[model samples]
Target: MQQQTSNQATRRGPLAGVKVLEFAGIGPGPFCGMLLADMGAEVILLERAGGTFASQLFGGGRKAVANRGKQSLCIDLKHPDSKALVNRLIGQVDVLIEGYRPGVMERLGFGPADCLAVNPRLVYGRMTGWGQHGPLAQRAGHDANYAAISGALDTGRRHGGAPWAPPTLVGDMGGGGLLLAWGIACALFEAQRSGQGQVIDAAMCEGAALLAHGLFNLNAIGAWDGRCALDTSAPFYDVYPCADGEWLTVCPLEPQFYAAFVERLGLAGDPDFAGQQYDTARWPAQKARLTELFGTRERAYWLEVFADTDDCVWPVLSMDEAPQHPHNRARDSFVEVAGIVQPAPAPKLSRTPGQVQGEPPLQGEHSRAQLLALGLSPAEVDGLAAAGVIRCAG
Candidate 1:
């Protein structure tokens, strides 16, 4: 286990020795980079000159939260000088992550073939909505569109109603970014044994479908017809509105937990409630009874009722309230960087703890410094800058 870092530490992090280069893009690419950086990897973000719209979302200058913990290099890939510089960098990096349509990197002359040719040990990660060679590989897509095709969106809504649009959590973060990160980590581990690297094709559709594995298994077992039926299994497993109209969640599914939950609500002694524990025929009535009881109290009252108990009940906190919640405060789940409050690095290790080294850089903020670190001379850096191959924030 790695030692955890105190909030006061300001030097190297656990992933300090790892080097990664990220091609600037939206959704999963930046997210994956952020995850690596949070874990202490030295992430360098390569952006195109004249600024990309994606760069602006994270404060193009050295001030964005998403871009935090990374150095930035701006380059004009079409220029021969820029191409050479990038190739040189690729030769030295351990991992390379990109999110672009298939063939785009090849068109830019930095595809996996070219990148691996320069460095066979480079773990190349590619993120896309479809995949590297699927029939829909060339098509454009967003979070919703990808989820729709993956059967994830289909399993989200209630049975009789139209399919509901799930929060971007499933397709973007879960399927897209997390899958890319997992693939990169696996490839890196394999590289240790094989002394070689490989390309990781992380597609959102496939990842989203993978996330629905349990549901698929249930369907196969004939225990589930679709999304809604399973979602309404128990009064404690769903959301209920309080007297103040705010929602609270309960998930006491285990028999013991369910018994405690019912007892706390003053419904434990009823034989009807006891007999209907697993009765699908009694769901409607059970739901109505629970709803009526919950509706009689305010959210705060319910919170007090479940306080210090294992009833598995909690209020649905708003975004602003979440960080201030007791558990989050105790765990330091959020951090302030450059005046921006955002989530902290997760799955903390006892040793090799992660840290946010610095805020995101402006476009090309570290072009000169990074190039210099790569062994380029001052004159060479200037020449490339003059040739319009690279830009420096200073």
Candidate 2:
């Protein structure tokens, strides 16, 4: 039988011919699958039986991230049919993704060795917080925990309070999930040359450390003191609140940009601000002065003042405000799917840009259809559903 493709009649985008099987878990695995599906790979989510994902039909009232352009197949891996089914799938798919702790998939009989035994060329991508062989590998950890242990958390301390947490973007999506996708892509490329596949041990801790690569400059440059405003604490690289209760962020790091920023803000004549731009002793006072100045005007007023120049000052927009902005609209940075606005596929390709194929699938929504494409008869599909080994959406 021909290998199963996307639920749609024909796949689209740069990865049109690739096939992936994603073991349903949560977090980073789904995100990696999302990237593959976005690029037009045929990604099928292997959900466990008895799960009710459609309860989140609206997916928390917005588009579910990392689940677009894929089909969800509810499979009871404990059932006899499951072994046959997964073995068949492993033979056809180009990659397999799972975000479980190291031993879970091995216990399920779909570990890297198990899958590679079935398909020598299948890339096995695993995403985890610590990794497959570390001391904390089996320990439960969320994004923030991993980021904290990786030393990224300390670098982002918000004044005297806790470090600013961006939900799961840093550790889960950026470090774990995005790195898993990159690992899979790299593995696939290497497979082309060697005709063999391997396991990718993508851990959030490692990825988080990599994400904070720039922080190494603190140690490399001995004179730079973060508390003295040489880094994020810098007066020029701060966010300020405006009169209208909105906010603006500035990052005039370069001398030229600082000049433009100082001139534009009418602070060029102020002795405390002019030649003292980089004086560590003056940063606190200058920050206070700019804070007061920015508080005097609305965000829109300051936006217009530096709109034509690269003074590095702009509104600090929220999620809803971002897509509505002119620059985002011009770049098509976000797209609408199922009447919900969400970010679009990024780092667009020149010839075959990725796109949002569809909304997140209902659990077992494509069970019957995918089974049929896998060469199962209608009666066989029904029998499996009747046995509670599978679910086909009514």
Candidate 3:
């Protein structure tokens, strides 16, 4: 694939001409910006004048995958001249994203009401752990907190085991960032017809809850208890450690698939394993038997055993092992950028597939050029940089 730069004119996706201004932040905010940038939006990351908590934490700004495909402009929102500078830029951009507490943007004078006054067609997307207006909206929280409060984390726990969710993936990226991006896209679409933009309140807690809708429906219908066929309590739909310490995921929910699984294991004649798939009363003993049976073989042995079967058993590859998997390699599921291996753009479109526009940028790396494009004179830009209202990197 040909490498593409962050130049807007050279972008080639469905969002090629869309303009987005992101108030730089950690977690979901940056992730949402990266999503839009990957879709060929002209995303201008308005970073803090000095640095961001993410930059300090990661220490390698150029390798931060979430910051890819963006031009950075570092500005002090607290500076007296900042409001005018930002409002001017807002007039030109189609979307504005910020992930701060409810009142922080209002305090900075760039709130939805404020920015919409300058540009009525601007889509203002606000991301938070709670929401813009709620009892816990102003409270401090993180991904785990959001997942826990939204009931998403609890549902994933085993019958007696404590709930544990993968950090960021459950709440931040899946709920907060991705949901906000979809909301922004919907709002942008509506704006094209109405010629008016609106604000999107994207809360991680709410997003997490939305993500668990299917589970919620099942639970409400009494079809799913704490221990069901879908959960790990069942022997057929669970992960087990092999003799080699590697793991395999075994899931055969359908009757035909279950037949294939038991037949492959040479247990088709055994009454203990040949019964109905959803025989809940026998799950515990069956799970124990399968555990012992799987432990007798290496993961590679099972992989070869089920390679051509519809038994739905496969290896659970680690992060380092995933990129080299045959299916992932065939699909180009990962890409290398500046010696760093990361996931490629997803949900491929046949005509205008998304691309990684460029490498991650440093704070203020494009400040001078972006500011000049906003119609600021070079002298004024230099003066603002000297006054510490803006930062310019070499």
The lDDT for every candidate, in the order shown, is 0.82, 0.83, 0.88
TM-score of each: 0.92, 0.94, 0.97
Instruction: Specify the poorest-scoring 10-residue window by lDDT in model 1.
Output: 1-10
Candidates in descending TM-score order = 3, 2, 1
lDDT, candidate 3, at 342? 80
Segments in model 1 whose C-alpha atoms lie over 4 Å from true places: 1-14, 56-63, 226-230, 270-274
Show the colliding residue pairs in model 2: none
Q: Say which prediction, candidate 1 or candidate 2, comes out ahead on TM-score.
A: 2
* Model 3: per-residue Cα lDDT over 1-394, one tens digit each: 2233445448878888999999998999999998898888989999886577777775546778888888888998888988899888999999999998989999899988899999999999999999998899889999999999999999777666898778898899999999999999999999999999999999999999999999888889997775677768788888999999999999998999999899999998887876687888888888888999999999999999999888999899998999889898888888876567788887788998888888888778899999999988999999999998899887
Task: Please report how far candidate 3 places residue 204 from its true position, in Å.
Answer: 0.7
TM-score: the better of candidates 1 and 3: 3
Give the Å error, residue 118, model 2: 0.6
* Model 1 Cα RMSD, 1 decimal: 3.1
lDDT of 1 at 320: 83
